[model samples]
Target chain A: MATSRGGAIGPALVLHLAVLAIVVVSEIIGLIRVPIGIGAVILLPILYAFALGIIFNPNVLKATGRVLNHDATKLAGTMITIAIMPFIARFGTTVGPQIEKIIAAGPALILQELGNLGTILIAFPVAVFLLRMGREAIGASYSIDREPNLALIADKYGLNSPEGAGAMGVYATGTLIGTFVFALMPPLVHGLGIFDVRALAMSCGVGSGSMLAACTGGLVAAVPDQKDLILALAAASNILTYATGLYAGLFLALPLTEWLYRTCAPADRASTMH
Target chain B: MNNEIAISDAPAEGRAIDLASHAVQLLVVCAVALVGNWVATNVSPLEALPGMACLYAMTIVGLVIAKYMPFYLPSVAWISLVAIIATIPGVPGAAFVNEAVGKLNFLAMATPALAYAGLALTKNEFAIARKSGWKIVIVAICVMFGTYIGSVVIADLVLRITG
Candidate 1:
């Protein structure tokens, strides 16, 4: 039975503790010189896949259903606006010549710096407003309660489901697929030589982010109640793994992959693709 | 007295959930995207682009989960944020976001708004599922992993053949 009590620690807290423990242990292990170069790149997708698998499992969905049902249309509109905002901001800038100079001086360096700043200038407020609007819309439709509708959704998606073949199997499969696709692009790009290894890596990495976002969104919608918690966990894990993976990809994976792609990819295949 | 109590309390409860969810969702989404962006940077050579891509991808994934599965936006956002933050850092800076200010900027300024917008635009839930489904997620993951493994294997093979 649920009680009306404040500061009550529950199973979720326990789980959070366990996850924290794992993170600490992993970091310690990482410090032991595990040849992080290659391992780091490979680890990102694997870890992310696993985390998301857990978070978006069925149990989470059951919880969300009990709390609320959001308006689908408003949510969709918000996503489109958010997606387009970056491009609009970038191209829409009035400082054309100054931007060109920065771009010309060092495309990657300048863009990286600008992008970071730009994301700040434009992205945050928009998201907050959208969320606020979404909640308002949801409120109009459903009764308010402490138990979040969002959490209920997490429960229903099998995110907190018992570990089984279905959850683990699917997650593993997805991770493998993501990793493989990421692995292939560098070589193909390297063969072209039109862009540096770093440039190719950047393109591929960005592409992966875009693809992952779309793919994750689709997965969340499709699985619904079967893997809510698993999905949530996996999503959480991806954030951690991807953080390292992104760095590794930028510094290590891209160069190594490019070298490999240039040397190993069949001359004919590389040539044909280029 | 009773009527006055009822009127005042009524609106508070009604608005409370909206306020709570909105606050939590905004914080969680922004935080996750910020952390995810940091992680993606570490994994790929692309620096910020990969991080951004991963953030976008996770957002999409979270949306999918929320739309179809029974998960809430806040929980998904938090879980995603924490997980990505945990896994991506091989070298502190490599996988992690460089400069606290940068991290703060992304989390504070960019993520919430974008997430809100993304969530808003999503529609045709049934169509999205029918069109993409589990197969697409599976395929996408496979392709990602395959590319990495294939690149390495092919590279090794080419070296051997040439030698």
Candidate 2:
């Protein structure tokens, strides 16, 4: 009895209305700025909206939860990319004003993408040696394991495999809590007061939109006046991630992870290693 | 999983709606973002109406292009391309586009978009995370920090050297 209509104002419409309500409420709640460590952090309306969205989650309560239901919930999730189009457009518009700055960024914008390799370089060792995870570490620490990474892992290794589950672990956590975790980084780094704000902003481009948004939001919160430059750099770096992250993950990171897996996987986990 | 290479695995994009509803849904989100822009940025809704309208139009055109284009580029790419083309320095009406669109804070719009994303999170996604054990959580943090710090260090060194 599923209606299966995309644009129809069905149960999903209720979800839309709920989003509108969150927008109104979170905005009015405004930004809550607090001093933490060396720099300050402002809780953007998005944070409040995210918290409220959790409260309104179908699993947590039966209020709007009941109305959102399964179908409605699925639709809400899909709307994520479309919902952020305006922000993407904003990123686009801002880029034009400072195309020169982007050029001035030299090879850094593209080279920074190499930083994605850091995931396996660091996470792999932690997963293998410290956590003693199995073949799962191969998939888990390979990449950020977003949708594309998940697909790549699934293609190379079936979803039910240990590797697949490992990817899913990181992917699921990324979906559930990645935003908040990445959001906290900018200010903490800013507190150290080492990296230039522009460089830090560029690092906020971690591939995922919400994560990027939260990261850029955090950096701007840490360094306010440079909003323009921060966002433009973030968006540019993020786009490069979208463009190159998959190939890099597929050809480079995963292979490196496999070699590392062979070298460092626990005895029991390494027995049948690929 | 499908062959279509895009960001999220959630659902198909424009295939979900017709032209009219597509336009309507975009408008609705834009309207919500407008309210957010007013509240968070201290700009009146009236003052930013032109900017919202401008963004809305660009979004519509960009989506249309994404739909019709022969290739498989994502909607965001086309939308961003249109916006970038419109506002880039010597383009006609670039200033008007800049000033008008400037009225709306991009972050303001992102608040509502993420609110929708927040509402999108489901119980199943959470269950998967929990079943994975706490070890993965630490791994997730390490991965994120390593990625961020690694990039910051590289970009900082590159920028300083070039400067």
Candidate 3:
């Protein structure tokens, strides 16, 4: 199956087969726990599945990778949108029977979206003066640079420009590594004992479904009793993020980061380049 | 008339395969998901079949609705709406839909979902990620951290005042 040279099996089927095999292995491994000094970190099957995927990619091992083909990656991106439907429905279905519970989360659901803007507040300056990046920092720092933002940036800057390059750069990196950071973040923050588990769970909605899943999975592992509420709030929070991330990134985040870039990049460049 | 305004990045070759083939592919995924739910969550595949089928049906029907709708609302939203209304309190069979879907762990579904996503992470994309160097990489981490932390803080405050 690995070395078969394009007899008849389509790349999409091959990709699904790879997912099926990985899912079996990953689920058997199940969730793992590691005791770091601060706390025990829970690693979900999804994390293992993600790692196995990276290794399975043609880049690491030519044998399995050859079956993936060039079109497979593009196909993977499209399928991702479809693949998460049940996942969405999984939590989305929770909304009705649990409507009262979700309703109680209403205000926090709306307010937490403002927190997404914190992406630029923290990343813009770091990308500019500290990192000595150019205006590309604008696109990179404004929002989490997921699909909607990618379209927003591409619409404004056309993906061929520096700003667009910055956006795509972060978008790609997020796809590669964001799941790990998101998965691990909940436990670390939970360890801090500052944020409520429900709040931490709600905040896990970072726009991308995989990132949201990894984050919510970490929290569910951390606080299993609260799993139902966590899933409800995370799903609702994600929907709000999807509906608003574009508008907020366009009207608020993009413009703000553009100004920040203008104020800092020129001075930072002059001193550093000199 | 509406197809030409396509926003989807679906393979142009698969253009003809959109609605029908998509449902078939989803069925295959639902099967894999059924197995994962069995292995990981101990939810019997026998027990999970109805809920799995329900989610599958809701998704394909939702996609069809999204395709035909006059305006452009996200299919995720439509799918979620379909699932919600179908299971909402007092609707016929709502109880069955609720109990059935609730059996299959959402996180179990997430493993395969992310796995599908992970399959797309190409070596070329990884190389291109390095083209901009580590600055954007670090910045990306900060951005993710910032949004997550920021949301937690705000949510913590609101939930506290309200809880």
Ranking by DockQ: 2, 3, 1
Order the candidate numbers by TM-score, best to worst.
2, 3, 1
Instruction: Show where candidate 1 strays beyond 4 Å.
Output: A1-12, A31-102, A105-195, A205-274, B1-19, B25-99, B102-163
iRMSD for every model = 17.8, 3.0, 3.7
The fnat of each candidate, in order, is 0.06, 0.66, 0.72
Candidate 3 stretches with Cα past 4 Å from truth are A1-10, A71-74, A267-274, B1-17
Task: Count the clashes in each prediction.
Answer: 179, 0, 0
Between 2 and 3, whose TM-score is larger?
2
DockQ of each model vs. true complex: 0.07, 0.55, 0.51
Q: Would you list the rank order by lDDT, best first?
A: 3, 2, 1
Top TM-score model? 2
How far in Å is the alpha carbon of B67 misplaced in model 1?
16
TM-score of 1: 0.27
* DockQ for candidate 1: 0.07
TM-score of chain A of each: 0.26, 0.93, 0.90
Per-residue lDDT for B19-49 in model 3, tens only?
A: 7656866777788899999998888999999
lDDT score at residue A190, model 3, on the 0-100 scale:
92
